[model samples]
Target chain A: MAHTGKILVTGSGIDLTLLRPLEEAGNSIVARPKLLSAAELKAELRDAVAYLHGGEEYASGDALSTAESLKVVAFMGIGYESFVDVDAAKERGLRVTWTPARRPDAVAVFTLGQIIYANLGIRNRLDERYPPQWSAAVPMPSELSAQRVGIVGLGSIGSRLAGLLLTIGCEVSYYSRTRKLAETTLDLTYRTLPDLAAWSDILVVLLPENPSTVNIIDTSVFARMKEGSILINTARAALVEPVALGNALRDGTIAVAAIDGHYRDESVNAALMREFGPRLLWTAHVAAHTRQSMAAMVDQAVRSVLRALDNAPDENMAVGQ
Target chain B: MAHTGKILVTGSGIDLTLLRPLEEAGNSIVARPKLLSAAELKAELRDAVAYLHGGEEYASGDALSTAESLKVVAFMGIGYESFVDVDAAKERGLRVTWTPARRPDAVAVFTLGQIIYANLGIRNRLDERYPPQWSAAVPMPSELSAQRVGIVGLGSIGSRLAGLLLTIGCEVSYYSRTRKLAETTLDLTYRTLPDLAAWSDILVVLLPENPSTVNIIDTSVFARMKEGSILINTARAALVEPVALGNALRDGTIAVAAIDGHYRDESVNAALMREFGPRLLWTAHVAAHTRQSMAAMVDQAVRSVLRALDNAPDENMAVGQ
Candidate 1:
């Protein structure tokens, strides 16, 4: 076990102080101060046995062609969809891993907040009430404990969120690609996508953005949702059709929509704001921005790379086949 | 068991159906459609043995002098301070009660939401980003699990909120008039107001508003609080000095303030908004406005009156000495 391997950290703005644990473990660190092209990265990758990756560079094709010694590449964030070419890495026999799924606790709490915010109509109240007209007749919000909440994704974040909602006595149901066989013991009911949409008083979207999920919730899904139901999206904007959502909110098909993520284009935000205005509550994709989550993600990424370099088995670290 | 007592319900907008539970128990119901004068209430009080009160007409001296047969008076909502004259009720041998202690679970969840909201700087990020300038360099919010949270009051709502925060792994401390005897087993430390302010990265105000609590969090307390700390108030607006809070937020003494309650004045809200628009996250005092809480309050108020009429030794239900 007397190995001094070179671990390359790709991308800038990473607080290198957090990687102190890796350095103290007797690894030689090579960090790229800026994002490099495939040609530039190949030279650095040639000698490094491990890499901590953050840039949007596709890692399998030309990027990994010269990395003869490379055994592992660890993505620093939860989502590795467009950031890495996992199939190519699999083909090359290189281990690939991503950080813990979406900082489960942070996202879960944020999801609960969004649910409360939407059901309570806080945004509309904030917008309309400059000097909130004191009224006992303020609309009574449906209790979280009394309503049926249906989640679209039941991954780590969604599962944790389901537990939180259950703690508040919400009747929880979820729709995933497959039934969560491991979590059958939880107090969650499994339903088909359309059934879930139709049943939910509040439908939460937590599915990761992927080729199969793009525009998954459109006019059809909106039409199927219960009348005056709410929508909360914390996962990705690509999963929802903004135009359809805007119409639903305006026509009261949806009572409210609390979104923390949007399409990468600024125009989408502008359009949503223009159409929905105060009917939409926005947070800047900050569900996973907690200091603890960020630190844990980096620490785990470093550990995964170290585990790979030492030939230790990592059943959960590797992302795809 | 043959009691055909008359129960008078004061104030407008009380759902008549909630009183059906009392009527089913063989009580005749009388509801005041609007705020009544002392003379009007005296006439209603002549026949009524139990009362559900809402209007601010003080029940003291002359008001209680006329309520000859009134054995119990229940405040329809939690706050009973300015609504009832406790000394008068006690002298007149009448029991007074208030319903649903801020819906402990509802307020606890809302308090946690405010902590996360303030710590995450959701409003600031929303104001600054359009479609979010995606960056790994996003400001890292202090983790809820990693920091110390100081609560100003550890009553039902605060005690429940402390438990919720503890579940999230926060190091919790509090400053109450007296240490909560029941919560000595909880992982909470009792601290002086100044010490709690100095030690906390997030200070929560849940104190019931009284003559003693008004303007308790003045400039001196703000000075004692840790720099970059956040404030959350779900209790009362009078507890915080808006001018001082605005100054702290503007000067960066406090990073953010999330408030759910405020002084019922248009000018105060306008002034606070004009000073710290984005930094002050506002929720319209709807923390306990859930349908579940509302129904529970009404149900409990009815039950308390029934219990009082039955000659039951109910010490806690009677609020005044």
Candidate 2:
């Protein structure tokens, strides 16, 4: 039988204009605006050549087993392992690809913005009706250029942030799995996590979440940080222990912090919000939600689907092919 | 009679440690932690060879005539014209010097911080407890690097900000008194104020308060600006017309704005605060209040006093020597 050339898009809210390139390539789109059940996804996969996964619905083993024509499972985001059953897809001889592009810049820029907001004491002055009374007792805020910035991970986002910090004349250091020799030319120094914490006036956490990485920034790391230093975490919240973070904020081990990603538990957020107030800048995981990044990821996901359909998947983005 | 070597400091809260350089030069420091009256200032100036003029007290012509040994009026800040009688000082052969150093970087950094704060929609997400619901209807925020930044003045602070913006990959343009030949090499474009407003995604007001510059950013400029554009003013409050700014915010001609300086009138602040809540990020004139800048200015002021005492004044800082 000839190919149907149908691509199934299962997401609550995907921009149709971004899928124009896929349609222009002579493929028909079967878009399910809301997340579908496993049985519904199985039925939709039977006619489609590729599935554009939207991260809400899990592509279960049963769904993969039922698909007759589906060659690829293209995830719109980086964390494909959580949504797609890799072994099941491999059993069905299907390619699983994800878009891991354009997010590093988005997250890095937002992290820098938060760092400045904290360092400049913008929160204290936010609600002041009158002008700040300049006095000897009231200490002045330090300049961004004069700060020593230590990044926890030397991944794409961390390295990009390090470069941005260097441009602003900040002393940049990192604590990664291994020291990057090439980055030394860019004046990046490698340090142990504890030492990085001690030396940094601004410690930024950007590590990926894994078994070993989860809760890595605990009480020990907080204890080593400079008094009145800032902490900026744009990474997963699981990397930082909530109890340790709350203690650090309470005892003044860390002067201020801005966390982009929050805990899954509503009670934890409520507790943190009630206890810390403006000292902690907590936000939902929206650091990588820029218009530029969204458009780029969507385009990359579509390209990944098209490439997989042609039996030539991108090695960087492919998981189990 | 020999020189008294006495320097009168007339700022309410000047850091004495910053004035140690002057003391180490065999000078006796007369620290008056208050804004003195003209009669009180004249009485204090009779014995002092160099007067460390603070911004608060007005050095009138009557006060200048009373000074017997005062050779230099070393203003601790840039705006000497507001505090010192230049014609009176010039007639008495007294050198007037003001510290105009180190503030550009301070103000520029703060301005960049506010720009990022506005651009990233941090204000919107600041109070959001739940994760943002991503949908096609909800528009995404633009990346800072993708922004076209239009600077109202290419003076010290504006030029420094333009350079900082360039390092982050922003398209920078300026409207100044005259086109800068040297800056064009750095990829800075010269535009008319209206053209700049129209082209910019972010408009920064950095002009000094003068007859020609005051109220430069009025209704017409706001009308020319891109819809949903951000305005950041770290300069004088008078430069931006208050009524027009309120109107722009009300009608949504501009999405958000961050102003560091506030008007003198209490009623104006109260009215604006009541009307535009989070759409405006208002702060006192504390953008240039960094520790580094403060120390540098105090040291510069001391050096200017020392140089004038030796009959060798810094020509760059001298007004009417």
Candidate 3:
């Protein structure tokens, strides 16, 4: 059983609550502290059947390619692109799967929370606490109900976000890939991206990053935007051209913006700050991170491993279920 | 008419939006640039007919005692204790009036927002953006439905906070000065402060500061609190005794706490940080500062000023309005 070489769980920040079943079933589990560089990773994966990619494994591409004996790579999230080399892994008879990183409730709550915090100026209040007995600097942020919110993508997160925004009396509209069916929970209107930009007092980027969406919010989209609008990004960074965003912020094209998902490094955030200015309220890529979601993600990961061990079929796989 | 004598609004951050009406009413309003000290304020108020207190004006009794012909000491807010000698002003035929600050909508929004941020670990995501990358932090925050909340000092802000919390499925309980009448909007159980502390997973303090309430949450209260319970103070700082709070957090008797109304200076916050570990989230007194509330506050201020002009007899008169 020790020589079975059944599974490998790579990365940190993973809840091992679900992975216990496979370990209990007498399948050999190879656990690294977290994802190391390619050399260190190659040393760890001498005999592992299925590969698990957690948060850190997605940082770079080198360690991913070295897991030679890996048959399946089941990502703990919908973002398999970060860790899975689609082209390289396809050539190696490797099947990649993902748990749709959809925590609609969590994201909806967070969106509403940030909406109030941004509108109500929680950051300014926090900063006032760090001062020289000064209280005049805090900006009393405005109300979201009085704000016109335009979302670029009306997919799952965006649609749910639209509902939350509506509950707070925000005027909501969105741009989607295809026309939506009919009337829905939110008072939503479909508009061209540019038109949406022009109308919105706050433009939140929630579009998925694909060939169509890559830098979709470039100069033209920003050029049509209202002067004092705020840009909030919980989506992929590349969805908006960073250069255009910086220029927009600098030139009074936007008043102030708050973001929850951007680069996970200081240098990157610093560069973003240099360009976009420190006015960007930042959080790491944790838009949908509720404990419920993480626990659900681990359950899915364990199922994938158990399926592979039992040689049974698993559906709902992102790339190849 | 020009010699009506200048009504000196000496406090900085004295609602510009509110003063617009006074300016338009032909009352020449000269706005101060900053929160002035007692000496600077005396110089500024040499010829002032009425002096508005923005923050604490004097540390001692004589500051207000010696000022002759300072007829009205009008306040922009309810915290007149910070800036005025109420009894002394009464003796001097100096009328001091204040706008009662209450914003259920704003406090409801902020309390819920901070609660979500705290129990859900919003700062973790904020921390994830920097040196400790998002992936390195595991067990992402939990959802609100899973949290157990307790409210202390269930006054206006706390009561409204409880209503909001109940609407969102929080296991809400409260401890007020007296028991509240039954209301289904908040299925709130009235608990003794000790019972509330013991049963609550998160304790939200919304008490006012006074001799009776000061250090009310000292070692005994912290000891009564459940392990890993969080403390939130949008009310007053003296409600919590920091030494006990530090000990609780350090020994894991309590987990973390957030205070938005305690520190008057960064040095005080810094001193707290030095005394207590950084498990505390310190912010300036800005819980009731949405734009809507600011506008409302200023509106009330204008009304008070106008009521004096209207020559209407009214109740709750501070400075013989």
Candidate 4:
């Protein structure tokens, strides 16, 4: 295991020094410091025993078939399903793992920041022509402590955000696929999706993007939301229906919506930006882009690779033989 | 006390319903909803026993002299020194009080939002030409939990902010006029202003705007701050020198600064906005302008006014005969 054939890393700007421990343990490293083409990745995987995936190149069934000696694939991010052919890798008797070590805290902090920003209604004033003057006419913002916050997914990131919101005195509720019995002690009330939307002063979507959750927040959900409530999505853009969100903002079904990362369609984003302006707080997908999170992710990915190659148990293993 | 004469309210947009308790107790409410001119204020004060000050019209020695029957003045906000002539009120044997209840939490929450927003470095992307793209080059942001935050004052707002930071795992220290023994149990360390500035990755100024505290965060303090550190001011604008802050940003002594509320000079703010652009996150000072804070302020102001007239003890009294 120590003298594994090779470990391939496919990611740009990842500090290679973080992988020095693996290099020291006798595995020769094949560092492709950029997203590789499918053929390029397949060619590289032929002689590798372990693959440190960057999630940039698609690891298709065809690519996995080419890996003659690959034993494990360690994805550097939580969303491995988007890039990795897990079924094909399992058929090849390869263990696949993802790094979810520090992402929850990072995304939670970013989402908290976005919620507070939107609640304060500061987006409208970002491009004000005159300097901000203190006026009684400036509508008084409601305190964040008093807000009834409804989280749409009780996953790690959502749970972390719920904890943060609790610290600030927000009344937090959630709608998850399954009721979390363990989380009941934390004072989180369980609500169905419609009930959560109806009761919330601020609704946040944090579900993963999959067949069941894609465009989960659509027209019907918007109709159930409280008027003038805030909506925040730090999760995948596909989890929220763009057209419905645009309509919600336009018709005042919700006061404002902030979506981090880009939608699949640039035209849809451009049109929404033109019409909604500050009512839509959009940023690049940076919810989990913190230096601390990145470092921990690299470390966790490396650990998973080593564990898999050594035929040892790894908690992060998503697909195992 | 129940039949007190002419209790004047001089603040605009205060929901008069909040003053119903005072009205019910038999005070004659003289409502001047807008900020009065000095002459208008003087004329109205001639027959008033209690004045609910709006901190708008300058309550100078000349204006106070005309208030022959004005026994008490309850300023609606914290910074009464700017609007009310406290020494002049003392000379006339009057009690002056301010409403400080519920403001600390409001400002603390807003300041926390600003710190997180600036830390994430999202201001530059507000006006991006194209939709945001995921790139490896995007510099990872440092986690707020790992930040060493140094607060420049240990007043209520500062203490509240420190408590909030502690919950997020930040290392918090303060440079206050005197060390707080009670807060010692809360894991807050005390440092000299220069030392605090030197050690902190993020320096927050929360000192009141008084003669001694004005321009306290100037060139010397900026020089002591860690290179690429962030500075946040949710307190009065004069507490940090504008020119020195601009210079610091230019020289890279600090990476970013977010100042809530407007500076004294419009030209200076305009020039800084032009030069610094996104490096300076400036907002219209809505930190304490929350619905909860406003309602609490009104109620507290009314109680102070009633207590002063009734010759009862009042804790909010800033100046007492």
Q: How do all models score by TM-score?
A: 0.75, 0.83, 0.83, 0.85
Model 3: interface root-mean-square deviation in Å: 4.2
TM-score of chain A of each: 0.76, 0.80, 0.83, 0.84
Question: Residue by residue across B1-321, what tens digits does model 3's lDDT show?
Answer: 222345566543445667766666566565664556667776656666555555534423455565564555667655465456666777766666776664556666677777766776665455344222334333456677567788877666677667656555568888877787633456688788899889988888877665567787889888888777888887666578877876887887766688876544446556667765346666656665566766776666665654554455434356563
lDDT for each residue of candidate 4 in A228-293, tens digit (9 for 90 to 100): 889999887778888998889988887878887666566987898899876777876667767788
Report per-prediction Cα RMSD to one decimal. Answer: 6.2, 4.7, 4.5, 4.2
Winning model by TM-score: 4
Model 4 chain A is weakest, by summed lDDT over 10 consecutive residues, at: A127-136
Q: Over 4 Å off in model 2, which ranges?
A: A1-16, A20-73, A79-95, A133-138, A306-317, B1-14, B21-74, B82-95, B133-138, B305-318
Give the top-scoring candidate (DockQ): 2
TM-score of chain B of each: 0.77, 0.81, 0.83, 0.85
Q: Which candidate is the best by lDDT?
A: 4
Task: Rank all candidate structures by their DockQ, best first, as comma-separated numbers.
Answer: 2, 4, 3, 1
Candidate 1: tens digits of C-alpha lDDT, residues A230-291? 89998777789877887888788887787876566568778878777666777656677666
What DockQ score does model 3 reach against the true complex? 0.34
